[model samples]
Target: MEARPRVAGIVLAAGKSTRMGRPKQLLPFRGRTVLECVVDNALASRLHRVVVVLGHEAEAVMPLLGHRCVTTVVNPLYGEGQSSSLKAGLGAMTEETDAALFLLGDQPLVTADTINLLIAAFADFPSPIVIPTFEGHRGNPVLFSRETFPRIEALSGDRGARGLFREYGDDIRSIDVRTPAILFDLDTEEDYLRLLREFPAV
Candidate 1:
């Protein structure tokens, strides 16, 4: 029997959160920091390993992650953009990893089921890139096969794997999911409050 492809969950939690006037990763959500919730969801998924990228307020965020069972990497170039954090996470992935699922730190509402759905799709379809959508709108926590790692590593600045979506359009697999959690990311106070109102139980 063929072995299952290994996939790692790369939580991008290194953003500075300038708009929110604080580190969004440290925001309180469901009795935990936003990043903690995101990491918890990743841990509950079918991923083989979970790597969290931290920046901005790394010292403060470090405490929140003390007891977690995930690997953490500090991106010194985090001020450069999201891609820096992506690179940091990728650097932490083991050589055996077959794919990576990039989860946003501020998207605490994204459920483990949604992540498992993407993992399952990657296993069946084996697309170079797999993403989730809701009601025709694309969402976060996109997965990229190992074959695309070089291209992702070539990216710079604020651009991320999404920058290559058009180039790999034909090979991309877009799975439609039931919840809009994929579309929600906390960038401002209003966004955080709205998420709390909408996903109180999360």
Candidate 2:
């Protein structure tokens, strides 16, 4: 039998959360912390492995993820920006991984189904890059084939894989998904309140 391609899930949680006043990943949502929710969803997905890149408040956030089906990696240069965290997470992926799904830790609303859908889409196309789009807008938790890892590793500043997507736009396979969860992220006080009011029961 042919081997199934391995796909890894990467949760980027190393940000400083400067605008949110405190660590957004540690914020309580429904009974669990935001980072916990994100990690749980990633673990529940079909990805072969899940990795979380930690920084800023690693001490507090590290314990919360204890013994989950995920691996934790620290971004020593996290202060550099999101790209640094991306590099850290991708670097920790297992050698068998043929692709990787990159997720932001603050996007607690992103569900396992959404992630699974992206993985399924990648399995079908096996493209260099796969991005989820809702309506006409493109959003994260993007999946990239191992073919693009070299470019991804070379990313600098805060440009992120988005820059690589632009550079290799022709190779990007855009999958349209009907999920508003792609638009949710906890960046400000208003965003937190909106999440609380909208998903009070979680």
Candidate 3:
């Protein structure tokens, strides 16, 4: 088989986090803010590039990111919804990148190894979409092939790539990962506190 093209790591950090009251991406987690942890983890992965879509206090988050070997894309239309940020990030991808590993900023527990596993699965079996499922529940940081880029770019409203996956079910491939971290995301202050208390710092 031909060598699979490289993939970009797209981290969506443009949500308002209304439930958390503050930008959940900037919330402290294990000493570092949530967005920092997510970006650091993505940088550690073997992705072609790491793109962060920032908005909803983009200035604050941008400074925290500093000079990392990652590309930052600001989503001015972030207020529109998550789909806007997703499209912006995907738009920044290079043609060399055949796919993208989409991650959420609030998912601080998702490890680089989990991301690598997903990428490896995609390389072995090229699919339009590669999703990770634990037990019976499916979760985020989904992998999307370039084939679905058009549909993803055309997405609107509050819905995300999930809608695209459902629309193209025949092209979706799933891997049964045993890790539950895929399902863990810090959406509120209580959620963050619970995660800190349960997992602690490494």
For candidate 3, lDDT tens digit of each residue in 23-45?
Answer: 89988878999889999999998
Q: Considering only N, C-alpha and C atoms within 3 Å, which residue pairs clash in candidate 3? A: none
**Tens digit of lDDT per residue, candidate 1, span 155-194?**
9999988998998989999999999889989888999889
Give lDDT: candidate 1, residue 81. Answer: 88
TM-score of each: 0.97, 0.96, 0.96
The runs of at least 3 residues in candidate 2 whose Cα sits more than 4 Å from the true structure, single-residue gaps closed, are none
Which pairs of residues collide in candidate 2?
none
Candidate 3: C-alpha lDDT: 0.90
Residue-level lDDT for 131 in candidate 3: 93
Task: Tell me the spans in candidate 3 whose CA falls farther than 4 Å from its real position.
Answer: none
Q: What is the lDDT of candidate 1?
A: 0.90
Superposition error at 145 for model 1 (Å): 0.4
Q: Give the better candidate number (1 or 3) by TM-score.
A: 1
Write one digit per residue (lDDT tens) for candidate 2, span 83-163.
898889888977788998999999988889999888888888788999888997898889989988888898898778888
